[model samples]
Target chain A: MGKIFQKPEALADVDTHYCPGCTHGIIHRLVAEVIDELDVRGRTVGIAPVGCAVLAYNYFTFDFQEAAHGRAPAMATGIKRVRPDLMVFTYQGDGDLASIGMSEIVHAANRGEKFTTIFVNNAVYGMTGGQMAPTTMPDQITTTSPAGRDTDEVGMPIKVSELLAALQTPAYIARQTVIRAKYIRKAKQAIKKAFTYQLEGKCFSLVEIVSTCPTNWGMTPIDSIKWAEDTLLPYYQLGEYKTPNGAG
Target chain B: MTHEHLVNRDKCKGCGVCVEACPKNVLALSEDVNAKGYFPAKQARPDDCVFCAICATMCPDVAITIREIADQAPTENKGGK
Candidate 1:
């Protein structure tokens, strides 16, 4: 009999430290599956961020470098420049990527780095006890914003994918979600495409995954998914924001 | 042909994400809890399983793995010839 539906080879054997309802585990599995299918685990180097996924290196069975707060893109840039043969990718959260590391990501993309990034935008700052991140939706209630996010006072939330897509440099920027089976499949496809483009030395590729933070959002796992579908999806607008060929 | 869904009880966190994603309604939170004091998901209706593996896909912890067993074929009577 043929084997079907098992753990991906690129993923570590030990259990994850993610929360029960956190989508980080699903995202990690998707990335691992992509790495396994691409056969780039040996040549891949992941940059772990300072956010909730700071320990992402522990989950993946490959060489990983820990970067400072919002500095993954810079670290990845240096690594990829020095060793062009290796596949470098950064696993970052909304707080790390969209906030403090904004300049690094922008400069990296503008320079047209040949690396991929898995941007997990859970809206709130998960590791920092649910603070208001740069990607936090309008009127969203976070620990820092007890009275809900005041867009007028704090300005609008940064749409990282769209922001990056506006640059003149060639890139493959997409926004995807993994709340359900259908979306998970698409997210995996997008992730694989990003890595494939990087392998071909096309351009900078980033897949912004609109994920859910049930614990931080103050909702149950199932309800948090529903919330994300109702609120986050409409705001984030999931799709291929930019491509090298300029085909949506 | 038969298909079996194995749940690694120790790794399960009993989040119920798999239970809700299972189209066949084959999984449910078992009465017994795991080492983490959480009710791990169990196959409540094994007969209705089609081995679609939706539960495994939605599983966050990679605690579930689906396997299939093919039936044996009949042997030909070569002695008579």
Candidate 2:
């Protein structure tokens, strides 16, 4: 018998605590796979954000550092600057990256820091009981926005990839999804490219994965994928927002 | 001759993601529950598996492992060193 599929070595053997159907597990696997493929597990320093993936350190076999809410970029920047040989990446959710940590990410990207970011955009804050996040789509109902997100009052959801692309610094920015197998494959390629860019010391790179929050969104795991495909994909748009030297 | 999927019963959370993703309907939630009190996914129709590995990709818990076995014996090497 020959093995066809198995867990990546970068990931720990322990089971994840993520909610069933939650795409966080998928994203985590992709990151770990990328790390393993790049052979950077020993030299990689991951900064776990203060969100649902806050305990991300417990799942990965490599070195992981905890960061304050929205402060992952700051921590990653410091680590990368001091230890240029190490590959540093930040795993942050929509709330941690788009809201409170907005300035941190923007400035880090603007400075063209050599680091990678895996931004898991599930729209609503999963750990905080599905509160309205900056990436929450317009007319999307969350615990904080029970009446649905009013674009007129709060403005439209922030397109983080596009926003970062518009900056003057040279960075690799892309938006992908992991709702299905096809998208999952593409997401892994994007993550691999982001890490590869960092290894080359090119510039700041980020892969914003438009994910689903089944438990937080009050929908079954299957329905959440459908909803994300219909509502989230249209608004968020999946593609490379920017790439260094015009390479996607 | 065919591929088989091994599901880690205790790790599976009965999410049904793999069940829905399997194009051949090769997997289903078992009636028996695991230690976690959730029905683990099982290979209901192992013969239909095409080794596409879609279920393994969709599994959130990394519970599925696919392996293919060769039915025929390997031919002996005719060339000597």
Candidate 3:
């Protein structure tokens, strides 16, 4: 039979150790494919954050550096500065990026660090047992907010892409999801564009992918994807928030 | 023309899913184990190989690649003659 789907070469030969049906695998594949297409796999250095994807280095064949929680942006900045010739990218989750790392991300964007960031926004802290995050939506239930997130107590969900776009240093920023085929295609394009921006030596570029957590969300894979499409999309609309050339 | 399913013996994890997925009945679990000490998938009939990547697709460890051997210079070519 003709090929339908096959794993990319950028991924290691080991089976993913992530929980089955987690979107982390999909996001990893997309980044790997983009890296392969850019032909920068050898020169690329990815910073894996302190979250569920902390072990992402083992999944991909490229050189990977581990970063502290919410410190990937700063780490990436240093890497790119020291080795400007090497392609630097950071893979961070919502808690790692929008929560404790917010200051680093904001300053990195303000400085135009010329690096790529793949932000996985599952709306909850997957690594820390479903804790509420800065991007967690109102009325959303997490382990810390079992009664559902109350805006009055925790404040509102931060529109990260919009907030980052307000900074002048960012060259590209987009919010996309992988809940369905249509959004998956858009997410891939946004990821590719983020890498392209880095390849062109542009300022900080980020693509926040709205993903699902079936095990943590207490829903099946199908329901988790549906939840992201139904609840998260409305709060985090899909679009290019900022582009240097004014082209998405 | 000939086809061969080249199993990267080092990578196979003794996952029997591939052995159960192959439709041509050409693949079998090897009695000999690999460096990993797993029963690697092996071809029972090299001549009957159709290069179906089903085994590769089912292999979560990505230890398989089916390669097709191009037919050598045609002994008798109907179109050319």
DockQ, per-model, please?
Answer: 0.47, 0.49, 0.08
TM-score on 0 to 1 scale for chain A of candidate 2: 0.97
Q: What share of the true interface contacts does candidate 3 keep?
A: 0.04
Which 10 residues in a row give candidate 2 chain B its minimum summed lDDT? B72-81
lDDT of 1: 0.89
Kindly list the per-residue Cα lDDT of model 1 for residues A34-83, writing each as its tens digit: 99999999999999999889999899899999999999999999999999
Comparing 1 and 2 on DockQ, the stronger one: 2
> Residue A3 in candidate 2 has what lDDT?
47
Show where candidate 1 strays beyond 4 Å: A1-3, B70-81
Better of 1 and 3 by DockQ: 1
Top DockQ model:
2
For candidate 3, state the interface root-mean-square deviation in angstroms to 1 decimal.
7.1
User: Candidate 3 residues B1-81, lDDT tens each?
Assistant: 544457766666555546666677777778887876767777765555566566664454556765444656522311110
The predicted structure with the larger lDDT, 1 or 3, is 1
The predicted structure with the larger TM-score, 1 or 3, is: 1
Clashes of each: 0, 0, 0
Q: Write the per-residue lDDT of candidate 2 for residues B17-46, one digit (tens) a residue.
A: 999999998788889889989888887776
lDDT of 2 by residue, A1-248 (tens): 45488899998999888998888888988898988888889999999999999999999999999999999999999999999999999999999999999999999999999999999999999898999999998988999999999998999999999899888784699999999999999999999998998998899999999999999899999999999999999989999888887744
Clashing residue pairs found in predicted model 2: none
Query: What's the CA error at residue A16 for candidate 2, in Å?
Result: 0.8
